[model samples]
Target: MPTLHELPGLAGQRLGPTQWREMTQERVNAFADVTEDHNYIHVDPERAKASPFGRTIAHGYLGVALLAPISQQLLAVEDATGVNYGMDRLRFPAPLPVGERFRGTAEVAEVTEIKGGMQVKVTLEIEVDGQERPALVADCLFRYYA
Candidate 1:
């Protein structure tokens, strides 16, 4: 948990390279099913091998969806009511092939006082283990009410 004053002071601070998580085929398939994004490269293992990636890859949006759970492993906000204000930008620089491990790190990009809360922009990166490029990069915003 972070104190009210602590959040403001955290601006420009770097958080963590969180525990790595595997991008399993099953998880990728489930995400594809739920989102109805049945792209062959993401859900069809055998067919994906013929694609440029040479293996089934996770959907770019799936990485975005996992940010909430992954961020929990990096930090917790137990003291305040936090609302997701949505993302500022998102990019997938590399493919996340199934069975690969990835982790996220966050830097507090900016913090501003709002009407009844504070809006914080966190520059987040989800990098695949052993890869130079990150699977996802996003500027996510959150509003925390004191």
Candidate 2:
């Protein structure tokens, strides 16, 4: 956990990469069940192969699902509770084909002290293996307080 003070200032910024496990069929199916985004490109493996992407693509929301886990590792937020305020700009430049690995990098774009809390905006870029473009990119805001 990261101390609250450690976060008041720009904690750190860099291009970080993670080698993810392959996006499995089971996982995609599970996400579909939970979100009700049963897009054929994400579940119909046989049919997906005939599409341009050549494989069932993972849901765009799955990329968002990784935010908390990755952010926890990236920021030290031990003493304070942070709220996921929301997103600003969001874009998915590439498809996340099933069985592919991807990772995210974040840059702290804005930080401010408001009331008794701190508001931070982090720009995130998610990329998949073998893809030159990013799968997801956005300005995600979070607020931490006493």
Q: What Cα-based lDDT does every candidate model obtain?
A: 0.86, 0.79
Candidate 1 residues 1-146, lDDT tens each? 57655778888888898888899999998998899999999989999999999999999999998888766655566666777789989999999989999989999898898887688899889989999999999999988887
- Highest TM-score scorer: 1
lDDT by residue for model 2 (1-146), tens: 55666665674455355446577889999999999988789999998888888889989888788776666556547778887889998888898888888777788887788777788888887778888998888888989887
| Model number with the top lDDT | 1
> What are the per-model numbers of colliding residue pairs?
0, 2
Instruction: State in Å the error of residue 134, model 1.
Output: 0.1
User: Candidate 1 overall Cα lDDT vs. reference?
Assistant: 0.86
- Model 2 residue runs over 4 Å out of place are none
Colliding pairs, model 1: none
